[model samples]
Target chain A: MDRGGRMTAVVPTRATAPASGVRAAARIVAAPDGRGGTALPVLDGAGPLALRRTRAVAPGTAQVTVVGAMSAPLGGDHLSLDTRVRTGARLAVGSAAATVSLPGRCGRSATYDVRLTVDSDAELCWLPEPLIAAAGSDLAMTTRVDLAEGARLVLREELVLGRAGERPGRLVSRLTVRLDGRALLDQGLALGPGAPGWSGPAVLDRYRAVGQLLVVEPRFRDRPCQVAVLPSDPAEGEAMLTPLAGPAALVTALAEDALMVRRLLDAGRQAAAAAAG
Target chain B: MTITTTAPANRAALLVLADGRFPAGGHAHSGGAEAAVAAGRLYDATSLEAFCRGRLDTAGLVAAALAAAAAAGVDPLLLDEAADARTPSPALRATARKLGRQMMRAARACWPSPVLDALAAARPRGAHQPVVLGVTASAAGLGPLDAAHAAAYEAVSGPATAAVRLLSLDPFDATAVLARLAPDLDRVAQQAVDSARLALDSDVDALPAASAPLLEIAAERHAAWPVRLFAS
Candidate 1:
């Protein structure tokens, strides 16, 4: 039901999307090999969203990285990425560099939809690079992850308000994940345009870099992690880990720079790993 | 003979629910002000106003929308799930449900309704505070607008009062800060009502997802403090 509904919703948006910018659809599917290694049966990319296989971190894992083929995902563009890790397989997906959004001639906001499925006993690590919303750019991004029972995942998303020295463009992002058809987390954040007080003391607080890390494991249901602060430079930013209602925990951080933001999130990832271990 | 007629709306009932002494257990939580105070981000009324404004636009707006949706006679169960999705911080979620249970007890005492009873039976522990607030408004013969206003008011009022205690500042200054935020509160309530109405036709995702990441992070850290005045 959800899959059908999502596809229907994407159709209308894609149909009316500005014709002046690139519209891309991509997919990656990984399955387990009989020899206990992971194999990518399907790796397809279209338009500006290109995919390349990288060396595996472990013998049983397959790694893929997204390489931007062009300066795409501009205003009025519609982009979609679908990835599935089959049962018993492990896959890690990342990007080569930060995605920079620029204003296009279409004058409409760009849209990016990421859909991921992790089957039972499968593991997926989604660590994409930061998406920079430069001035005059308007983009809306949605990330949805569906996990079967016993699935494991580590997902991270980071946003950079603007480039080196300028006010940011409008960026609206939503992250929703479900485990066994139940909601684990659904958070929406709006920054840049149309979001008042985005940089206020209570929200971003003069910080430009913000991101969240979500980690999940089957054992968390029996032994949930504690809510605590992850150590980081006070001058850089702060980080915290809060267990979700399910077998997962979320780490949220805000920092003065993208590098610092990554550091805070990295600390969270390690803490989550150590706690789960 | 003196006449007693059922008015168009129980407008005065809204005041009772919105009262600070409503026995909802909200007074125990500082709404992140205690954390902000510890971090030295809020000192005088000036910084307090800024923090309240930011929170109102984000968390406050989201809560108002949830309350309005519940008051509009939507399924409380669905709205409860929606609330869970919007609240990413476990500390905040637990705090909301704890307060909801407290409010539920008071609502049952004040206004007896089968709907309230049904919701209580469904959520034996509790629902989200805003969802319960909306149902309580409905049981009291109020409308979605009233519920939205009440929630939006609570979002900042709790923190403002907490600051007075945490900072030992003048009570008058805190009240003044709320008075200045009256306009922002109105805007947030209106926005929430609009989103609630939209959610009636669409899914709950139509509601705003605005969040204060700093507020959430601070609340999580505050829960670990050795000794704190506020529960959240």
Candidate 2:
């Protein structure tokens, strides 16, 4: 963990789980090695988490994958992920599979906390799999991102309330995004059972899945991005796109199921990437 | 650093601010009720009540907390950022600032204050509606609880009023809907005040972050409506 070219020790900050449960933590830090290559001097994980860095897809860019046990139930599990992209570096992180959360034996809620930071002139694309909250399960997740001036980011989050024909469990998602010490976005939602009329027309209107794509770049603020409503395409669902005050744009879509949401999100990602470029 | 007194001088200011006909430009917006009505989701008194109740607990609670924090003397710029963070829809965010600018004009004419003037100067385009509301409440010598109550009441009252026009619901029923939710409004206002008090010692993130995704989505759709009675 080098701060301003100074070597700082990378400390393993692990969450203390109960004796009957499991806790996982992963940290990835990427920076420029000064030889036209990306350096990942800090990559570590603990518990039911694993991390791997692939070959650079582009100059000074690194691709990483976060893998968890396929058979192990994600009940009562606490997963913490920390990512940092230093100056002049780019990192793209994604998960290997969708997380199907289940009710823990101890009845404790599963949690995921992600903290991401991008330095000046850096970029990060976070494309995680959809989180499917199973019946009778409880899950809470939060994502906090800090970006420096001139940094760029494209982050996507997809959520599915439940499996087919099953009553969805509880899922609460919270996000806080800041640029240059100023908060740009702060949003929280509680979905599934006990949530207030989530399927109401003024809300989700019976949509079972939702996706959000956020793109932030210095150039986007100057462009006159149109905020239009597309016809409700049966396969694509409903989509709305809008540009924010600064270098940020947001796209929110709702669909009949996870596959449709993913389709919409994929299209949104392509559009946002092109706009950011 | 006591800029204003904790004790309110004008208890009736709450009533004045909470009035729907204060000429703050609130009449043009249905608070997403137009979208719901067009979608055939709110056609009767019962469904309108359900919609109002849902909004009061989520977006209403968040707005009340922001208002309470502003009345508690938090920085208006910070609260404006907090409001932006809480609002996910760009259309809604623009609507808030528009309403805020309109409210500032009225507040300046109604209650002249150096603080309000400073805020107006700082945010010439506008701040957020809840931020302006809290600041106006403070300028009017109202307390944090008063600001919270006003915010909470507006959350449901605007939609209820809009429903009357959109669905052609009876005025009596709309007013009755507000009356029935009075107890819930009080509870939400109290919770807002408590959250604001906590925010005083901690980060602004301590404020409530409750949100209604459908309302946010509907607002975006409503903003693009070619023929709509309400603005959002």
Candidate 3:
């Protein structure tokens, strides 16, 4: 059960989720707390799973980490993950470290799809470290969340262009996020080549960096941002976006009191400052 | 006791899903057509049709089913959460919520169903496009299958229609694209009806996983635009 039967130890297992390959995998670990809360289970030996010990961990700070590629991963082998935070549970899962790797060939990419569900009176935070797509590599990832009545979630994800010594321009990354059934957040980009928007005002504008965070909670509605950053809260959900600026267009909306101000910035510096807050 | 009138109730559900004016924020988005045009990936109706086809086969199909289910009296918020779990692109998810909000607005305006008000109250969860579509269709009295067809058609149409203004495609050709997709619309609609009957825990993995990578890339690239006209 190895490649061409040449190897014997790495056979794919039936216990794994369907469409899963050696490149990626995911699992859930949770046990109810004596008082009614629950503990998050570690995912596939990837690292420690983060769960709410009390109502103490701020909303936007949960994070988790999973190991990156070890050897040359083949096609059809991609990561799949799912997590559930039950009623009255609090959790934050962040990665231990950034993912690094030897870039794959052109036109090849690794895929990761994660599904998380939060129930009433529950809060979950996922602020994982950045993923480093090596030179000439392409990475495609999708993360989805389902929140029940009174549920809350805060998710943060980032990607670094080319790792270490590779030229930053040779990476391709695409990420999509959906809430409920309607397409909430969908974006994917392939860098390199004559990809029209390469230097255009309507595309990346030569920026090699991008980051996103989405928080869903009713409590987030009235909170105001002082400086660029908003502190994590238990009652509300917040999605704070930080663009590299770098000539790329910035589109954002922030609510103040009863009024919300949303504007686009032109320079990377201003965008960075705005993102920081 | 012979018969008074049931037209209003019969059409109530259909009105909820069919109206594009819903508060789901779909108006702010032109699908990827706006971004594709801005990126120059799309130049005319032909390319626009191709893009629509890809989306319909993947995201469009899912959104259609989810909405149709919601229309059939399923919980819109639950459907919204399920849809959210499926979308991976942060930007795309944001766009969906924006469109969802818009759909709600339209729904509240034209069809003030108690269910819609309840759904709206479940704010910040971001009512997805399909769930709202489903709930609205149910309120309108449209059959589940028919609702699915219309939902799919609209899902695909939104982007194709946007292409008209974004790429200078002849309106006639755009209409033709819509007309041509009729067969696909029916086929997918039937499939959705059948799939809806499956147990929630039934073999979802056995079903084909549909995804459109290129469109996703286009969306990501679209997010960074400095002066782009499209929201997603």
Writing each residue's lDDT as its tens digit, candidate 3 over B1-232 gives: 0111123446545544555654455555777778667655567766666666666656666676676566555556656655654554456666777777777777677667888788888874557766766666655555566667767777677887787777778989988987888787777776665555451334222112243433444566577678776677
| Candidates 1 onward: DockQ, in order | 0.61, 0.53, 0.05
Instruction: Estimate how well candidate 1 is docked, as a DockQ score.
Output: 0.61
DockQ of prediction 3: 0.05
lDDT of 3 at A230: 23
TM-score of model 2 (CA atoms) = 0.90
Q: Which residue ranges in model 1 land beyond 4 Å of their true spot?
A: A1-19, A33-35, B1-8, B168-173
Model 3 Cα lDDT, one tens digit per residue, A1-277: 1111111122212333233334445665443465554555554543122222223354322234443323323223466677777677677776544543233323345666677777777777765655545555445556656666566665655544554345543334434333333333433444434232232222333333344445454543333222232222212211133221011112222111101111111122244434334
How far in Å is the alpha carbon of B105 misplaced in model 3?
2.3
lDDT, residue B86, model 2: 81
Docking tier of model 3: it is incorrect
After TM-score superposition, the amount by which residue A16's alpha carbon in candidate 2 deviates from its true location, in angstroms, is: 15
What is the lDDT for A56 in model 3? 31
Lowest summed lDDT window (length 10), candidate 2 chain A: A1-10
TM-score of the first chain of model 2: 0.87
At residue A184, candidate 3 shows an lDDT of 36
